[model samples]
Target chain A: MIDVQLIGLLNATLQAATLLFIAALGELITEKSGILNLGVEGMISVGAVSGFITAINTENLFLAVIVGVLSASAFSSIHAFVTVVLKQDQTVSGLILTILGLSLSSLIGKPYVGKKLEVKLESLIDIEEPLNIFQVLLNQNLIFYIAILLMIFTAYVLKKTMFGRRIEAIGEDLKSADSMGLKIAKTQFIATCVGGAFAGLSGVYLTLSYVPYWTDGMTSGRGWIALALVIFGGWKPYRTAFGALLFGFLEALGPRLQTYGFEMSPYIVKITPYIITILVLVFLTIIKNGNTGAPKNIGIPFFRENR
Target chain B: MNKFILSKKLYRNELATFYSFLIGFLIALAVGSLILFIQEKNPFDVFSLMLKLSIGSVNSLSNSLNKAIPLILAGLGISIINSVKLWNIGAEGQIFMGAIALNFVYINTSINNSQIYIFLLLVSGFLGGAFCILFPAVAKVLFGVNEIITTLLTNYIVFGLTIYLINGAWKDPASLNFPAAAYVSESVYLPTVIGKLSSGFLICILFTLIAYYIKDKSVFGYEMRIAGGSALTAIYAGINAKQKAFFAMLIGGGFAGLAGAIELLSQTHRVSTGISQGFGYTAIIVAAITGMRPVGIFLVGCLFGALTIGGSVIQTIGVSSYIAEIIQATTLFGALIAQFFFSYEILKKSEND
Candidate 1:
């Protein structure tokens, strides 16, 4: 019985972590490129609604995911145009994007509220027999496995590739990178779009697999948590994945604790993750003494003439 | 062949903000009209009805003012912090915390004097908001932590606490199956001047005037401006930049808290999760559009308030109330583009010049 419960908890944690890691990793990429796109929530909303709508109409999971990703990327291009091309404030633009995304999603999604899609993504392995611990962990949806692979891919791209070096160079010092002939605006624009795509993917997973039904504002505050996770991870890919898992564990622990007859308000349990995020940030800041691994030009718009 | 280049202006254009806001407002209306047209609704008729419902009558205008009270206060709070180059994105949470604190004090105390009870609630509300931001302010000053994330994270925590209290402890006993607190005594309720317009409007205006004076004509404001512009320059000028920033954050939080308190006493008179309808977030746009000028915040807040009221009214015609938010968001974008144009002039020049 204990073994089964433990496995169940672990599976839940992994599911939650998958969502966070995908979104945070995307945000991590954008921040690394020195473009702070705070519209993760907005992108996620657009992705979720569009993906859910497409899934219901076509009943094809693959096409739905593609549509979701493409829609979110298109939505994020607005941020790129406003902040990168026009050189406006990234923070304000991102916030507006969030407002626009949420409102627009609700407007578009009003007709589909409470609607469920018949088609669902199946697990990678469908073993019916009593499974071992390894099998229990491995028997997850295709998106779960995809999330892991994406993490690895992101780590390699950011660490090993020449393009990765250029992104970091642009993030660290815009003038120096521009002098080096790096296409600052184009790189940032692409990075922002990629981040939006990831956010959309995470949202698609939420509606398609996690909930399997359409609900207004279903992404809740996960996008914000993912944003914090990037900071908690110190802007590193592997560290971000680890942070996502830890948060997932905390999120999963609350309901499990209640089932085990623990007398605790669910709200208090819900509040734990946010409190821990702040505490961890404080601890990280104190120990590192201000080297939080943030890109120096993270929020500043790159202007070639000014440089 | 001729090309255009952006040349930075030598002096700041004072009328840029005015023109930018005008352009932004017009652009938002255009976008809203397009959406309405797409929905097969007559844009002109819908817009005229929206304006009529929101501000056509004195009573509706007063209703808009009542709604604008908290917005004005919250905008003032955000403007204060922005002046010091700090972001207090947690104003939403701070508003909730302030309400919680005010309600807690009201429940615990046995004070019967209406004036004292009101004053105490106001003070507690301010303190609660200040407390909400205290951690982020200290973290930013001491450890150089990014206050934006910290402040934002706290909002969720406060929201969770609000839900817990509403469901568990503060749930009204007399009201069956409802998750809300008991209403405060009627005596302590803020007196309404005209229609639903409470004395809270007066309080908001007073604070706005005070903030304007402090920001423009005070020595502390001068220090804050210098500190925000450049820490090294502030240090050279014998100013404690960190301290100024810290105080600015606290004052900002205090204004949000005061807004919460006024909201409670004047509007709801009971604690619930729906007390703040994104007033804090909307205030950020208000402050940004007005460049943090207290008077401008007041004007913009009332305009947004009218939009919100108009949005709800249009629902009778089968339009989604989300139209208000859509317009608000677009307005920000429009203002951004206008500001860009105002700051950088596009000059036509010969390629070989």
Candidate 2:
């Protein structure tokens, strides 16, 4: 029989992966539409605070989740305006968004700091067995199901749908897209907002389902990790979700290993995600695959005057 | 149908810069007012209070001066690297390395001399910061990796390293339960240039002059700008872009390291991760806000320094210190938008239509 601890570890891995998958899905869609929102870190933090505050006061997960999504989308609208409408540097604006998110969240989240909630998101269905593989995999929260559905939804839209093709077309060749009469600004703006909403949903999961607490900088660098995961996944939904699961396993492995009572530096666990990102980038470039799954116009702003 | 559109200005018009910055300031103030109104406080009173506390008294002004020392150094570092069009986001890590280096030197060296050792400590700190960015610089040149990700990741790694040092190896046993690095001796502390502030301000001024000379007069500065403008063009003109990137990163990292060392030797007096408080990121914003001009960076660095110190003054009035950060970020975003207007003008729809 598999020990209870091992099963718990497996379950934690899925939970962690689900959060990353949701956020990376948002980034994937954003990047697919030729927009880079580096403000995921900021957006996630904002979502975390807003979600936590809403959960505490209202105890309504539905409202908390909506607030979380809308607030982040609202925050990222500035980015869309700057990068898409105004034709500014997207990278700088995205980074600035992060700074704004973090500072703003901390500033506004002051009263809600150190607060806790009684209710938390529970597993959709109770497990039939105590420590079985099926129980570990199937008995998960609503967000886990959302993540799986989103992956399929994203993959289907990007492959079979005309909307996905339009986004990809714009990302690949903005001039061509513009000439084709595609609404570049409108498309990018909506895609970016959706990305922000997904990112914020990840934040709600963090505060509402995962830690179920409110604190400053609680999202930590998960947003950055998700950003990297999008790249590591080669901008594909399936691959990115897989990569997130792998990362989630790695994240869970460290803590689970600590429970084994080994003398190790916990700091190693903290640095793992960061170190993994650089390594992934290095190795990916080294392989030099024919197609390096990146949106060609990822960071470059589309200037209408240029053509 | 009539619609307004921004047209590119052929010549660099000074009026555009003024108009854009004015608009940026106005937008930032408007947003700030909304927040203040929501909080039920007079926006004017708070703004004036922040201004008064920051620049009104000698003590507060000196405090701002003291704070600006590190910011100016870090900003100058960022300015130089930015001129080469290579982002050095690792300045935060570099600053930490600098603080770590000086702390190791100060506590371990047991150097009895003052002047020589202090100078040596500052240099070592600069070297420490430089070494932090060396890897990303070389990797970018040799491997074609993105420095933005690498630099940012390295910062986290070094931050973790700092936590390890403070909580574990460097933790003072006598610190009780606090778990901090060893405290520096009083003798090695930087001398005061003014009331309650250390002489690091003077050193920053010297660096500003040096930075100005390099930017305008130095042959290397000329090369860096050309390389930044267009790398393919620079290469066609026989300029080695790799060497420029290498040296540019080196200089940028060095300045940040020096800031770290000076911050420790002058103000903080010890090593800790919180010592930087995102100065590396703030310096990047400062460099951008000032248009990457050395003198502009100096003046703007002081402005940010004042804003930081003044941020604390309003907490008692039911405000959060993060309000300072919100204002700064809003202004940064506004200024970024302003740059667009500065570069372009809305051509009035002529009646010729």
Which candidate number would show the highest lDDT if scored against the true structure? 1
Quality class of the docking in candidate 1, CAPRI style: medium
Q: Which ten residues in a row have the lowest lDDT in candidate 2 chain A?
A: A283-292
Q: Write the per-residue lDDT of candidate 1 for residues B40-152, one digit (tens) a residue.
A: 99999998998999999988888888888878888898888988888888888888888999999999997878898899999999998999999999999999888878888
| Candidate 2 lDDT over residue span A98-125, tens digit each | 8889988887888887777878888888
Once fitted onto the true fold, the runs of candidate 1 whose alpha carbons sit more than 4 angstroms away are A128-130, B1-4
DockQ of 2: 0.58
**Total clashing pairs in model 2:** 0
lDDT per residue for candidate 2 within B145-181, as digits (tens), equals 6777778778888888888888888988887676668
What is the alpha-carbon lDDT for the whole of candidate 1? 0.88
Listed in order, the DockQ scores are 0.71, 0.58
